[model samples]
Each structure stands twice: as structure tokens, then as C-alpha cells.
Target: MDLPSDTPAASRTPRPARVAVVTGSDSGIGRATAVRLASQGMDIGITWHTDEEGAHRTAEEVRAHGRRAALARTDLSRLPDAAGVVEDLARELGRIDVLVNNAGTGTATPFVDMEYETVREVIDVDLIGPFLCGQVAARRMIRQGDGGCIVNVTSVHEHQPRVGAAPYCAAKGGLGLLTQVMALELAEHGIRVNAVAPGEIATPMTGQEDEDVRRTSRPGVPLGRPGDAREVAAVIAFLASEESSYVTGASWAVDGGMLRMGPQAGSHLESDAWRRP
Candidate 1:
């Protein structure tokens, strides 16, 4: 068949693999997601806060899959400035196809005892950071005239409350709603937005990095064990790929049925047996 006389050169050529920017890819779910996306043939942009070495290791893993990898240091607490890292990665990688807002922080202090600065920092990193980063990535995708995907890594706390996690819950809850709004608005541009809420994942945050989740136990959870980072990454990979092209504005809970337990988790527990399943 003959081509149109005015067909653009770029569109006439074969398209390259997608490129993805994953924040806090130095470890845990972030690292797992980056590698998983790479295995699917997408180039990855990795961000680290304080763990440069870990980020480099993640980049190496991406390269091991024969995908390109770029590195950047992102301090979500730094505000609007830190969000620019998304643009930086897009420049280095040639284009932006996906953005995973996985960088986060939390507080374990009692609500009443928490200092103003502490609350501000948590909200800044967990909520505002993803918000701004999404904006940067979305604008670029719009300019390129291609749809994109943004996955915000919220937590089970986004829906449920933990006694000492006031700020964390508030930020995650806000991000959850933001995902829906972004989905509604960006759908016209072929973009999709969604949230991934995890519970008791075996990550460094939970002091269970590299721990075999099968050997561990969680009595309150329906699955009777903590989740592995790879499990959460698999879900993220789906959302970031064409596999979930029709899905958006939704929250997928990758918690071993912990959310289903509800009040029964507490009411049914008896004695020391409550510590293990």
C-alpha cells in the first residue's frame, strides 16, 4: 500500500520501547517495579534519596535485562524543585511513557505529640511530591501526543487508620483521591491514573527486606503471611502496561486480604496466639 504524502517521519518509523520513571527505586517495591518493567522491555529511570549505591544496583539490574537505565537523586521533601527530576529523566531517556510515584515516607509518632515540622515533611514527601511529579510527566506526555500511565503507591493506611500514623494516612488518602481526579481529567489525552495500596510488604520499610515471606507469619492477615515486594511489583507492571489499558481511577489493594479482616482481626484474636498464624 502507498503511504500518505504528508505522513510524519517519526510516526512512519518503528516505535521504540517505552520508558518509565520510578521514584525511590533504590530499594523495595520501587526497585522491584523498575526491574520488572525493564524485563518487559521498557527503559527505566531510577531515583534515589540517600542510597546512591542501592540505586546504582537497581540500574545494573535493569541493564541486565538489556534495557536502558538512567539515575537521578530525588528528595521529595525538597518540594517543587525535586519534581524536576521527572523532566530530567524524560530528557535522558528520550520520552516518557510511564511514571510510578512510589517514593514515600511515614511517621510513627503519636498524633498529639507530633511536631509541625514532622507532619509537614511527611505530607510533603508522600503527597505533594507525587502530585508535582505527576504534573511534570503528564505535561510531557501531552506534548508528545501519546497517552501515559501514572501509578501512585499508596498504602492500606490510605483507607484505614493506624493510631500513630496520622500524617502518613492523611497524605496517602489525599493521593488516592488525586488519582481518581487525574484519571478523569487525563483520560482525554489517553493517560490513565491509578493507585496501588499495599499492606505489610516485606520491604526495608517494614524491616523485612530480603526476608522470605513464606517463613514469616501474620495471624491477622487472611493469607497468614506478609507480602513480598515482587508481588506488589507484578501488579504495578500490569497497570503500567497495555494489559491494564482499560483500567483507571481505581485502587488495587495488594494486601494478603488484610483489608477484608476489618474489625474481626482484633475481636477474634485470643492471647499470645494472636502474634502468629
Candidate 2:
């Protein structure tokens, strides 16, 4: 956490504008977050894996809010190289004030039957990817001498494990701890870090793209329905904004009370179907 020769120990000056880079922003939670942050007056940097069209759509939405939007193709599996998207976006946006580590992948295979390559890919994309990207964003924020924030998009599995998603659970669990460590180490540099864990959201990853969440029902959840991507985005927006300046090293669960229904879920299961993917 060494500061640049010209960088001050801390900066108290007000900024004229803010910029944010959200990875995996081509759709779902990432797209919603980019749009929400844009509406809050922050220029957005969006990244896509395989959906250039979706990334452009996100950019259009950001521009509609009167904020600038920059696009890049971010393949987390590419490792150290892919993390450079943050630096590229920061340069394009002039400066970065926020970074949402939203890009991730997961596996549904059971631990015993999983392939090493598949596990490696999942961990690389979900855990190490965010680690490197967070470093890139944080170093720039330090050099800029401005206090900033980073929001790591973990999952509900970060706190609890699923039977068939051994690798997914492991990566998310690792990310949850990584968020805390980053928060602790970066506080002196004025960079706050936190994690947001989402439950079953109406996202393409959940096979519910553009689906109305209100029409869905989850008997085990107190809210009784899947959450909308916008709902998760709202929490991420809070973490990225100054409104949550004092909050760090915490994990916010946007799970419709599903995490609290652990024991109930266990007791109410009618069959062993829950044991498989």
C-alpha cells in the first residue's frame, strides 16, 4: 500500500465527477448495476465476455442517463491480462472512483466427480479474477489519491454450501474472505471493500432472463419469490456510493430471507432430490 511520490496520505477534496468499472456487465445483475450507478451520476465502464450486443445495450442505457460509458471484452479466464480492463477503463473514464467485481462463473458438479480443469476454471473466474481486478482498481485509486469503493459480487453460497456445486461454493466462499481482507488492508488508502451475495435472482444464469420475478414462487423463502436483478443492483449501488462510506468488510445478502430459512428448508424437504444438481 505504498503511495506515489506525489500522492497524499489522504485526500479530502471533493471530486467533480465519479467513474465506475463493472465487470461482466453485459447483462443480468451486472447490466442492472451499471445502469443504476449511471443514474446516480457516475460514468460507467462495462465489460462483456461473449455478448457484445448486450454490452452495447448497457452502454446505451448509461448514456441515456447522461453519463459516459466505455466498453471492453473481459475474459476472466485469461487471468492477469484480463485484469488490465480496469486500467484501460480507468484511463478511458479519466479516473475510477468505484469498482464492482461482478464477473464470475460457477460449476454444478459434485466434488468427487469434478474435473481438475473445470474446478480451476471456476476458481480462476470467480475468485482469482476478482482478486486481480481489485488490485488493478485499488492501485489506481491509490495513485489518484482519492478514496474509493469496491463491491465484490459473491453469491448466497458464499455463506452456505450446496450439494452439487462444490467448486462454486468454494470459490464464492474464498471470495467472501478475500473481500474482508481487502477491506482491512485498503482502508488506510481510502478504498473500502465489501461483498454482496445474491440468492435466486431472475438472471440468465438462473435461466430466467427478462422473467418477471413477481410471477415466481419460492415456498422456502420468506419473500416467496425469486428476486429481480434490479433488487441486487440496488444493494450494489449503495455499497458503491458514499452513502455507505462507513460500511466495509461486510457481506450484504439479497436473498429474500432464504439464508434465514436454512433449518426450515432442511426439515421441509420432501425428497432427496435436493442432493443432486
Candidate 3:
């Protein structure tokens, strides 16, 4: 069992721990994702736009799981450069193996009443931010000469429209397509790109922080309850892990059958006149 004298010393050394950058991880699904990945042994880079306290708490949780966690402040709405946070995190964590574009914002104003700035902000946070972050992470992965994973935390709105979520829906829809394109282009470099579309999760975004989804009732959801951030994080972890090595360019719906109700509910309506008359 003696090693050959010609064997390089570097080959005898263990590979560095994998690192993951989870943006908007100050709370909710992002926080859950950071912790989940950490549980899977990834050193985490946690980012927050406005929730510094929450980000620190998430970092603590990641560390509690015996993983290193780096913290950063990132505002995706700043665009074109917001992605620099990824590089910053990579620098702090030594290397980047995964990038989770989980940061986003939205407005409920009607389309006609929506201010230009509001729409622009939504697009900048949801679409442009992921685009830039993906680009930066991909380039770093390519340079490192190792495969990587990018998971974009899209929403159920990506495929289905909500009454007051014009900007949110549009931005998520765009990110879905962008995920596919990134997968196609980065496949050559062994980078896997995918999107996770979450339904009504019991997160701060839904005004249900720390609430147990099992106790809450969601009549619209087929499961009769909202999802948990951890539930969505589990899927994200899968996508970010070697378990999904063959999976890319796909949008996995972590919804509780919420997306399936749309067509069924519409078809059950007694009036066909609204369809096309």
C-alpha cells in the first residue's frame, strides 16, 4: 500500500470543503436553505438586503450545524453589481460550489397604477439579480475547473399569475427562462442550473414568520395548508447536491399542489362565455 514516490503531495491532501452562497438568507426560505445546505456539509455564505440581524442568526444556525458561515449585505435591486456579493462570499469562504439566488422583492399595485420605479425594482431584484449572480458564479466555477450548482428561488408566480402580482410574476417568469439558458450554456463546464418554485410558504414574506404551516389552513392549496421553508429548502438542497447531477435546466415546483388548482378551478366554472365569446 505504499504510495509511489512520484505521487504529487497535493494529491494526498483532502479537497477543500464546498461553499454555498445563499442570498436573501436573512430569513424565510433563504435562511432555511442556508441551514439546510450547511447540514449537508457546505460552508455557507449568508447575505441580507435589510435584515442584518436575521442574517447573523442564520449564520449562527449554519455554524451550529458545524459549518463555516460568512455574512454579507446585498441589495439585488442595485443590479449589475449586486452579484458582487457572490464573489465576496467566495473570497471569504475560500471557494464557491453553489449559488442560491433567493433574494427578491415585489409590489401589489395594479398594473395601471404601478409606478415605473416599482416595476423596475421588481425586475431588478428578481430577474437581473439572478442573471448577474449566475454569471459571476459560473465564471468562477469555470475558472476553478470544477462543476458547480446554481439554484434560483423562483415562486409559484413563475408559472401562474396572481391578481396583484404583475411585476413579481413577470420577473419570476423571466428567471425561469433564464435558468434554462444558463443550464444550456454552462453544461459544457459541468455547471448545473435550476429553479425552485415555492408556493405559499410560511415565511416572513407571507407574514407568517416562525408560524407552523401544519397549524395554518390554506383552503386554496390542495394540501389544505401552506408549505414550510424547510420543505422548500429540502428540494433546494437536493438540487445543489450531487444527488441531482443529471438534473439541470428544470423548474421544480415545491408547491403543495397549488399550481394544479388553477386549470381545474377554471374548468369547474359554470360559464364558458368568459373563456372566448
Q: For each candidate, what TM-score against the reference?
A: 0.93, 0.94, 0.92
lDDT of 2 by residue, 178-271 (tens): 9999999999998999999999999989899999888987888899999999999999999987778789999999999999998888998899
Clashing pairs in 2: none
Task: Compose the digit string of candidate 3's lDDT tens values, residues 211-253.
Answer: 9789998776799999999999999999998888889999999
The lDDT values for all models are 0.95, 0.93, 0.90
Measured by TM-score, the strongest candidate is 2
How accurate locally is residue 109 in candidate 1, as Cα lDDT from 0 to 100?
A: 79
> How far out, in Å, is residue 102 in model 1?
0.3
Worst 10 residues of 1 by lDDT: 268-277
Model 3: what TM-score?
A: 0.92
* Candidate no. 1 TM-score: 0.93
Candidate 2, residue 7: how far the Cα is off, in Å? 20
Question: What order do candidates take by TM-score, descending?
Answer: 2, 1, 3
